[model samples]
Target: MSKTKNSFNHFAWEYFEGLEKTQKGNTLIRKKGRLELICSYIGNEPISEIGSPRMLEVLLDIQANSLNKAGKPTDKAERCAGIASDVFIYAGARGFCSSNPAALIKSQLAKSSYGHRPAITHPKDFAKLLRAIETIVGDPNTINSLRLLALLFVRNGDLRRMRWADVELATGRWQLKPLKGQGKVNMVKDQVVPLPDQAVAILHKQQKINGHTEYVFFSQTAKKHQIISENTANKRLKDLGYQNIHCAHGFRATAKTLLQEQLKYPLVLVEMALGHTTKDPNGTAYGRFEYIDDRSDMMQKWADYLDALREGRDTTEFRADAQNKADSTAQLKALIDQLGEDKVLELLKNKD
Candidate 1:
């Protein structure tokens, strides 16, 4: 293909098509939307002719017009700038453009001033939210779906696109594909979430309703898709009067806080459980399934703690148990460092 024939529109379409192949479910929809916004503002000019000036114009236009979930006007200059940068980088790599002009003005884009997603960080507030989730009237699937989101605390996109084939109920495991742009090439692997018994029960109930469909939370009214809307869980929470106070994504913040502060789980383990990539002391990437047994135990304990909070039960015992487990893990690491793996194993075998 001639570089002159590769217009911005053509380049964008081809770029997003590549993204569709590599990315999963709703991720493509979002990238397509972003591409549309870029194309609409930047016109179908030749890819080589589009430079920093055209990119800045599009960024300014998006900043003045974009509206967030609440339909309030907000600046999305940063997001548009990012999309432009990526598109131009791809174009440059393919020899459509000599340089990535979008990257030149990326830092000039206005930063988003939106506050963090609201979460019930307080124990009393979280307890009340849990109670509200339990009693909220609607489709049983919707209710169960929200409950599972809270319990697992995974991203909304991942939760809605959950495939039944990825779940192993017998082993209480949910295998999650890496999000868009996160996988083997990125040195990230598929995340394996150790589902608690409560999470398993929720899945069982959901299975009864949506077993026929590939997605656990299937949308019957969707024209060509089986997965539920990305906004379904957030909308349900908003309906129950949690519009600003809580959202589907806020469950992550809630879990991060409670798991670390109240439960005393190590920060590294918590981040790994959240499917975030972390590095070791020597800058080596940790495996996705690292600390599987400990993570499973932590998840179950986290679920039990949530239940205790909901029922207004004492959590002192749970805290103690978590502390003891952390201590045991620390001691084992120290022993391993002092003695080789073979010696440690032999000592344990002799004790047994």
Candidate 2:
């Protein structure tokens, strides 16, 4: 039997070749590897003949023998399924395949326990982590990268690929096309990062070092780009005794939690500042500049709160401390009016 033009191997390669045109760096490599894995199982089989059950069986066989990047036994089956689904979708659009067999099979894969990215969410604990970062004695590029990571909380790839042209220190804004936004999904493609005073100062210091380079965190040893190694920030965290306690990507979770829970920022504004794609009530996606002014204020407040936390100062919930203090005063005055001034003073004295 001869393989057809639309055989799994030929069509999947066609799909991936198209993907390679749009993707770069490790992303392209990883997707290609996953496609190869799937093709290894059914390379010569007609893609149209590979139903959901057959796909599931091949994935299960791969799962049984492979380990994930974290060395987990779950393997790359889930990711392979995703890649296969993409290929089938591509093929279906051109009338090569009728349906995606790789879809709806992820739930049937082996149940595996994977840990969430470790992060420090508690304010006090996170404060300690910040202080520890300040004391880290190493390459200034790595140190400043970590500092900016805490303040910016963007994906590590975004930070590493940060360019001088995108950063406006005078206006304290970073405008860039986020790597994740390069997909077919309609998201906030151009993310506007409002830099705080502290972050601006760090960038100023970095300017003297990397101003001549393309990337803000320039590195001579980086093979993929002149930017710093992806592990630079996390490796420093590990050296600071935060091996599993925290990592570079943890800052996003930490900021997301504290910005809503501790800093008292509105979820929509916080999500916007974090470059997350959130839909409005009408199901329309918000643009990057939708709430620019409000997000700017939130970013500043978040930076100020982090400063307070690092200095071991009173890290009151952002924008709520003053109102809360005023409320307390009004309650005290009402009590004093209900009782007598002398009685209220006596009660206060007793409480003290």
Candidate closest to the true structure, highest lDDT = 2
User: What is the Cα-based lDDT of residue 270 in candidate 1?
Assistant: 87
lDDT of 2 by residue, 221-328 (tens): 887688889888888999899998999989999999998888777788878877778888999888887888888878888889888988888876466355688799
Each prediction's TM-score versus the true structure: 0.80, 0.85
Candidate 1 off by > 4 Å: 1-6, 67-75, 90-96, 180-189, 320-352
Task: Give the per-residue lDDT digits (tens) of candidate 1, residues 1-352.
Answer: 2223578877777777788776755556766777788888664788888878877777867766775765554546676666777888888998878978778775776555566888888888999899988887867768888888888998887888899999999999988875742633542467889999999998899989998889999888766666777778888889889998999989999999988888888887888888877788998877867899999988998889889999999886566255777789899989999998899999999999
Clashing pairs in 1: none
For every candidate in turn, the CA RMSD to the true structure comes to 8.4, 4.4
Top TM-score model: 2
Q: Looking at model 1, report the run of 10 residues with the lowest lDDT sum.
A: 180-189
